[model samples]
Target: MRQEKLKYLAKLALLVLMGIFGSFLISEAGLRLMNISYPVFHGFDPVRGRILEPGMEGWFRYEGNAYVKINSAGFRDVEHPLQKPKGTYRILLLGDSYTEARQVSLENTFGRKVEQQLQSCERLLPHLVEVINFGVPGYGNAEELITLRSRGWAYDPDLVLTMFFSGNDLIDNFPRAELREPAYIPRPYFHLDQGELKLAYNFQEWSPPILKYRLLLWGVHNFRTLELLNQANRVLAARHIGDSQENLSSRAGLADFVYAPPQTPIHREAWDITEGILKLMHQEVLKHGANFFLVTATSPDQIDQEERILLKERLATKKLDYPEQRLRALGEIEGFPVLNLLYDFQQYAEQHPAHLHGFSNTKLGAGHWNEQGHELAAQLISKRICQDPSIL
Candidate 1:
């Protein structure tokens, strides 16, 4: 009787396992059939640190619902030939997430908008213009320098545009030791040694196992079910840990340091490193025979009147525009043209009276640029390029 009971239990267990496996397969097939996928687009790169997963496509519905595709070159933009076709004027864009502009659709991104607008320019009427996006989220100038060296120059672009985001690029360039708070993602940093710039791999050296990263990436890439679960987990984690930067307090903390002048020794060092990196980038672009331009991205606090007032009241300073001023000054000194979008963005916001930075799902005027912001940015950038005969 005991043997019979054991056999029955074994049969039941087998049936349960089979049922679960069948259910998983069904769910996976159903998701695939419905063409639904979660955005798991980032992949680890030993050189650049983090890059968009090549040939990855999914529905980005976190901040806004839009389908995103990463070309086989790992750029968020459309595919292009590596060898520049004859009579083609290619522009390579390097920056952090602002250049990536994943919050909106690819067509709505400033890069695409700039490309579309420039197509009608009479200066280069016959030559086809292509703008390749080499932006990655959470990247600082350090990574951008590496990317320009390793990947960007290969395109043989006629112009290289670096979109500098003061919000975190200023803070993210320094070594982890100099930072007051630990960086959420470890990254390579550039440090000056005897007035020479050197790459420090402290972040990579101290990071967790690469195998773990590879496995997670593989799972997300191959399994739609895993992708959904991974996104859900991230959302849950953000909620539980209060990690989203959409809150007023978080923005205030960031603004206090970034919006103001370098108050501490670390802040000063960070600025030095940032400027050094930019200079190096300029030199490299010149060496490659391409014109370089730096554009400072607008911060929400810099545009939002209410947020600006609140920040000024909190920080006890009216000099919230220090970051843009520093970048403009740097461009002037370094002989590169700078299009400071802060003033224009501010003017647009005051006139139009709409949110440029954030969406309805997230706090308005607190995060990445919305569609209107990108549209305005494209207008300004294209106008600058068209007006400047040197770039042509």
Candidate 2:
């Protein structure tokens, strides 16, 4: 009787284990069929601070629902040869999340659009055009400069364009001793030491644990169910920690500070560090026998009249284009071309009455650029480049 009971118990345990395994397989298949998955693309890089995981592909559903694929080179765009092809004109773009543009498909990005437009230009007909995107999310000028030196130069680009986001680049450029708010992610910062530029890799201590992180990444990459769980856990963790701290996630407070002259020492130093880094980048591009240009992306608040009014009321200021002016002034004084899209973008918004920055899934006017925004930017940039044939 005892032997018979043991056999029956053993059979029950085997059936339970098989059922669980079968259920997991079914869930994975269902999720994949629905095209639902969440994967963390960016990871800590000891050199550039953080970078997208190479060859990682997934559906990004946070702000926009679009499939994104990182190239073997870890860029959001399609891969190109390291050595420039003969009779080809290559342009390298360096910026932050706006340029990375995970919210849209690779073909719909401004970089790719510019390439398509420029290729049709009469002057550049004989020469094929190639634009490489080196943009990484959360990157500031310091990381951009480092990117150009460490990785960008390999592509042998004829021109280098830095898309400066006045919204947060100033704050991201320098490292602070301590923050009254949470430090979301640590990055390599540039500081001026005795009138010379120096890089501080303060985030080295926070580098991801290799074996454990790799195991997690592997599971997230392979299984859609695991990815969903990972995202849920992340949200819960953020909520638990965010309760005690002043919400630093929103840019509301820092956005206005950029419009005026530096109010505190940190802001003042940030401006200084930003200017210094821009100069260094300009010089570096020239040294490499390439032309450099700066394009300042319009912040969402700059185009939204209601938000503008509230910001103005809060700051009690009549003018809010200080950052653009500073950037233009620096460009002019330093002998580099600078383009400010605030006026044009604002004018378009007024006449057309459409949200260029945000998507339908997200708030209409609150986040990254949408399809229309990318199209307009491409048209404007291409027009400018063609206006002066010599620029090509």
Candidate 3:
């Protein structure tokens, strides 16, 4: 009996060791096959498969296309190690994912389109015009302000154009502990004091190099694992509101799943926070001797107001509120030039129905610009820039 027990114990120990070795081998093989490398936070390294520089420092791998840090501010493709040329007019473009050209290629981005147009012009003011794309995904006025203050001045921009999206930018600016780090990572902070909003640095804490490396390794080798973790996070986020019904809808046409937060009042304290961030951003732009222009984008709700209202009513029936009016009102405030593209895009879409072909038809999903959309944005923006004698 004793000899039989010993044999069983040895067999169990061998199985455990084999399992451990198997896991390690699988992880190592996965990393090797994927060619993954550790990405530096806030630094752009192209060799390691990192696209986009000087921001959150994560590998932006989507649809097999990669973007490394192009030296131009925002999303502009220009000569690296940017040197302000004697006769070049520098323009800095700032915004969120839409401005980052997430759904489109680098050359197809609006900033690149504008640059191409400017270069094509052989008329009098043809010395040289440089438009840099400083837009980062998930950034709001706070991050935009910080980026402008920190990096915009270096390029000596003659004009700074900031794009605002209604859906996420406001949410991005709100003071939430969940947005601290490792997820929804941001570089700026807003403080609300007695109805007044203040801006401050929120990026003091740094991720350890080893942890960052591990995350990179995991991100590359275990994408499915990270995806599962993200899904788990969404489930937790939904549970935070204690609501039975959830909007577990993903972005339109794309399989990427997103957790939709419970509807909150449009005029809630969040707008106050957003307003404060914008105020600081405007002031910062002026401080650098650069003119600021506010360009707005369309959300799906804005595309069909009646449908949005109905959706809001449904949420309201459930004791939830959506901050639609507050956002529009905030945009109306006096300060910089505001280009509300919601109305214009809707009108254009109505006239030319063909433009909607490339976009997803789902009303709940976010809309991306096709070639027409990009052209329209470029034309309107460029026309506005030319109209402003100050920018010239």
Q: Which candidate is the best by TM-score?
A: 1
lDDT of 3 by residue, 75-120 (tens): 4354534578888877888887778764555677788888767765
1 or 2, which is superior by TM-score?
1
lDDT for each residue of candidate 2 in 255-326, tens digit (9 for 90 to 100)? 457887767766777788899999999999999999898899988888778887887787778767889999
Which window of 10 residues has the lowest lDDT sum in candidate 3? Answer: 250-259
Report RMSD (Å) for each prediction in the order shown: 3.6, 4.5, 7.6
lDDT of 1 by residue, 1-392 (tens): 99999999999999999999898899899989998788688887778767888988877777855688899988898888889999888999998889988889999999999999999888878988899999888889999999888988788999999999988787668665323333334467888898888998644533565556667788988988888899889888777544444342243334257787766666677788889999999988999899999899988888889989988887788868888888889888888898899998988888887889998887888889999999999999999998897666
Checking candidate 1 for backbone clashes, the offending pairs are none
Task: Compute the lDDT of residue 2 as modeled in candidate 1.
Answer: 100
The local distance difference test score of each candidate is 0.83, 0.82, 0.57
The list of candidate 3 runs beyond 4 A from truth reads 1-79, 120-124, 177-187, 200-266, 304-334, 355-365
TM-score of 2: 0.85
Candidate 2: where is the Cα deviation over 4 Å? 1-35, 177-186, 205-219, 233-253
